[model samples]
Target: MLIRLAIRDVVLIEALDLDFSAGLGALTGETGAGKSILLDSLGLALGARADSGLVRHGADRAVVTASFDVSEDSVVTGLLADNGLEGEPGEPLIVRRIVKADGGSRASINDQPVSAALLRELGTRLVEIHGQHDDRGLLNARGHRALLDAFGRFDTGPIATTHARWRAAEAALEAARADIETAERDREWLDHAVAELRQLAPEAGEEETLAADRAAMQKGARLAEDLGHVTTHLDGSDGALAGLRQAARRLDRIAHEHEALATALAALDRAVIEASEAEDALAEAGRAMAFEPERLDAIETRLFDLRGIARKHRVQPDQLAALAEELEARLSRIEAGGAGLAALERAVAAARTDYEREAAALSDARAGAALRLDKAVAGELAPLKLDAARFRTAIERLPEAQWGADGRDRVEFLISTNPGAPFAPLVKIASGGELSRFILALKVALAEAAGARTMIFDEIDRGVGGAVASAIGDRLARLSTKAQLLVVTHSPQVAARADRQLLIAKSHDGTVTRTGVRLLDEGERREEIARMLSGAEVTDEARAQAGKLLAA
Candidate 1:
């Protein structure tokens, strides 16, 4: 509920701070007493359109601030989080709007800077303002469905889930159709590529192995002479191993003659053994480097085929296998299009059936709820001097294109002000005075269901008096039981019903004027009501009537 409002340099308002409480509060004043200015100030804080002319004549700017207290689990908390704004759940939501003399505006919430658009978005969660020309409340057609659904206590979640599944089915069918279309466009290329890849049967690691083998085979032919030269030093005709072997034989024969001779003979034998081993290694290497043109040709052919195919596909040699697999899969899907399409179509049909069932149920629930709502609102009219007015909840089926998860129904509150009158929309059919009373009837009907913590009506008792005015007051008081209600009224009967009353008045200091509000005490309230009852003069009879009204 709105907790406080402050205004500065706004038209006739100089500096004002009004603290509000939860209940049926009334603001009463004579004409030109700045009551409208007070509401305008509140509207500015709620992100209404700014006007430079609203600023005081000698002031640089005008400012209005409104604060509200809401529950921790309210949608407001989620909205704040979604917008990246920090909020403490226990603290009041303070929204401030400042209008510059040059026709500019700035907005803030909880002293943190915000855009005016954002402030307005938050305002809808906290306060609902209804006037003759207001459209944001029940008058808006977009909100009618939700409002009706909320009132009916109907859960639309199932419909939403079913709709989501239907949409998913649609997406799948589209994709399958798109795949078929694309495959039709690329049929020839796909067939050729798949056939070539199947024939080649490329392996993931085959490219590197082939390249290495090709390099070894090609380089081995070029290094044949150099390899032979190295072999000659160890195992060829000019190798030193023959001389060492001849020396070892001679030394072994003399080894028995002397100990020193035996040592020398042992060394010669060991050297001969080492020379033979080294010669064997050189001979093995000579075989490894042996030239073979036919083998080299085979390796070159394999490497060239792999590299050429990879380049043709504009892929790395290693990725060729993966590319081949992907193409094979797409081709397989295209071939299976008939069965796949049939399955998708069946799934779409099933999902649509599911959605239709749930949507039908929701539509039935709305029809039932609309009947009850029409009855309830009609019951409220006669007491408010609208006995002949016919209230209706129009539940019409929307076109196929506008069908939604909430069902295919378009719900709107319509009215007929006279007998035999064709029903028209609520906003279009009512006069200024009639609209206010109609708004009052709606408030009485939807206050608890609206989910708005604060409901403000401007002069809802306009052009009403006696028992009709009293009836308006009675309904306003009942609405306050559901939520915080504030009404600006001229009727003494309405003023007498307030849980708290504020008298808006103007005062002058020197040449300057200011608007202010004061909470009326019991005595002051009686006098104020008397003034309302008797016009400018509070006669004894008016005071007695005011006393009786207050007592009642």
Candidate 2:
């Protein structure tokens, strides 16, 4: 319920603060006395569009703050938690908005900054404004389905889930069919490529190993002649080893004759031994470095074959193996295309069946709920003096192409104002007053369903008077028992029914004009109602009638 509204520098309202209780409250004043300005201010706080013209003359900005008391389980509380705003069970929820003269605006919930869109989303759950010109709430056919579901207390989560699953299945089936068709078109190429790869299978890293081996063998071929020359020099009859042996024998013959000769003979013997060891080491290296021409030819041939195949497939040597596996898998899928496509089709059929079952059940339930709703709304119309009118909840089964998560049915509220008249849409057939009354009747019918805590009716009693106005007032008061109701009315009958009455009056201070609201005391309320009854003048007769209306 809306507990308080504070406004500053908005249009004709310079500054105003009003506290509201939970019941029927009436704002009564003459036309053009700024009753609409108050509603606009409240709308601004509830995230309505901002306009620079709303700023009062000579003021740079306009601010509006609305506070409400929401229960812990109310939709408003859930929205607060969703937005990270503070709305403890025992505390009030505050929504504040400021509109600048430059046509810019900002909003906050509980002092935490928020976007205008978020504020608007939360506002819908907090208050619903209904009037003859309203396009939201009950009048909008687009929201009719949701209103019906809420009235029926139906949970639509299951059908929504089923519809999503059905769509996914359809998508999967389409993709599989496309894949099979493309693979069939390329069947010949896949077959040839897989065969070639199988015949000359290329191993990973084989190219680099073969190239390195070929390099080593070619280098060995180049060094073979030089190695032979060094071997001949080390082991030839006139080489360094043979000369060392001849010198050692001569030195040994003379060693017994002189000490100097013996020392020379020993050094020559050591030189001969060193030369022999050098020859052995050279021989071992020659054996290790030897290369055969046949082996070199085979390595070159293998490398060439690998490179040619890689170029043919538009891939490197190492990637040929992976590419081969992928092609083989595609070929296998093609061979089994008939079975795979059949499986996908069956899956899609199953999903469609499930969706249809759930959708049919929901449609049946909606039909039943629609009948009950029509009955409930019928009970409300006569009291508001529309006994000749008929209300209908029209549920049409839409075509399959238009099926959706909501169901296969389109629901709209239709009415016929006179007997034998065909039922037509609410907007097309009803006048402004009739539309307002229709909306009221619908609201009363759906009152038991969950909805916004506060409902504001803008002149719902516009064209009616006397008993009709009294009936409207009585209904408004009755509706207030379910939710807070604030009505802007000119009917004295309605004014007499209000638990609280506020008078909107405009005043001018020579050069400046302003509008203010004053809560009426019992005597003051009686006078205001009397003024309403007598038009600009308050006669003794009007006062006596006003007293009777209040006393009754």
Candidate 3:
């Protein structure tokens, strides 16, 4: 429920603070006693567009603050929590708006700065202010579906769940189709690439090993001639080592004849042994240096081919094996495309069946709920002076292809104002007065279903008077039993039915006039109601009737 509204420097309202309580509360005053100004200020605080002309003549800015008392689990509280605003369970939520003379406005929720758009969004859930020209509350076409749902008391959970599942299935099917298309487009290229790579049979590090072997073989080829020349020189037919050995053997045999000759022969034998060892080592080197030119050429060719392929593929030679594996996987997917596509189609069909089954169940439930709602709203219509007005909760099947989060049904409130009149859309057939009454009836019927803690009606009795006004008041009082209500009204009957009555009046302080609101006592209320009933002249009869009305 709206607990408090404070206005400062807004038009004629220089400074005003009004405290509101539960149940229907009426605001009554003379024609220009700033009643509209008070409502306008409340609207501004609820995120209505700011106008520079609304600012006081001498003031640079205008401010409006509206405070609401809501439950801990109210949607408004959840919205505040989502926006990171601080509030405790059952705490008063305050929305403040400041409008400047330049037509700029700032808004805040729970003292935390917020955008006007967010304020507007949060405001709609908290308070609904309906006026003669303000078609936002119930006459709006966009809100008809929600209104119907609320009226029908339809449980949206199953529908929402089924819709989400259908969407997921649709998305998966699309992705699968896209994948199949892509694979088909690349099938030929993938097959050729995979076959070529398999034929080449590239291996990691093969290029490096071949290149090393090639280099070593080329170096050996360059040294082969030199090794052969050395071998031939050391072991030729006129070799010096053989001649030295023969001389050493002859000297050693004659060594016993002379001791000095024997010592020289021993040194010559050591020299021959050293030369023979050198020749043997040179022969081993010659054998090790032997190389085949053909083998070297083959290794070089393989190395070049591996390097060229690696470069063409834009990968290191070691990565070729992994790249080939990736290409093979793609080709495999392409080959399995038909089977995978079939599987996806089956899955899509199953998902569609599940969605349709759930949607049909939901539609059946909604149909039952709509029938009950029609009866309930019709019951309320009699008391709200719309006995002849027909209320229809229309639930029609939408195209399956156009199904959405709300399921496959389009729900709307249809009405026929007069007998024999064609039942048309509520917004199209109902006049302003009828619309207000219909909205009140709907609200009264769905009060419990809406789960709203507070329901405010701003001049809902605008175009009605006499018995209709009294009927509207009776329904408001009935609605108050379920949720708190705050009503701004000019009807004496509505004013007389309030548990509390507030009089919005302007007080002149010499140079300027200021607006102020006060809770009227019983006597004060009677006078206020009398003033509303008789306009400028409060007739004795009107005062007496006002008293009788309040007593009743």
Q: Judged by TM-score, which candidate is best?
A: 1
Q: Give the TM-score (vs. native) of candidate 3.
A: 0.79
- Candidate with top lDDT is 2
For model 1, the superposed segments whose C-alpha errors exceed 4 Å read 236-238, 241-291
**Looking at candidate 2, what is the lDDT of residue 462?**
85
Q: Show the colliding residue pairs in model 3.
A: none
lDDT of 1 by residue, 1-552 (tens): 899998999999888889999899999999899988998888889878899999999999999988888664358777877877656758887889999998799999878889888888888888888887787787887898888888888888889888889989999999989989999799899999999988888889889987887777667778888877766765645567777777778888878999999999889888888888877776776567666888878877877887888999999888889999999998998899999999999999999998888888888889999998899899999998899999989898889788777778899889999999999988888898899999888878876575678888998888879999999999998989988889998999999999999999999989988888999999999999999999987899999999999998
Question: In angstroms, how far off is 272's CA in candidate 2?
Answer: 16
Which 10 successive residues of model 2 have the least lDDT summed? 71-80
- Could you arrange the candidates by lDDT from highest to lowest? 2, 1, 3
lDDT, candidate 2, 250-274, per-residue tens: 7787799988888888888888898
Q: What are the TM-scores, per candidate, against the unseen true structure?
A: 0.93, 0.79, 0.79
Deviation from native of the Cα of residue 435 in model 2, angstroms: 1.2
Q: Tell me how far the alpha carbon of residue 310 in candidate 3 is from the true structure, in angstroms, after superposition.
A: 3.5
Q: Is candidate 1 or candidate 2 better by lDDT?
A: 2
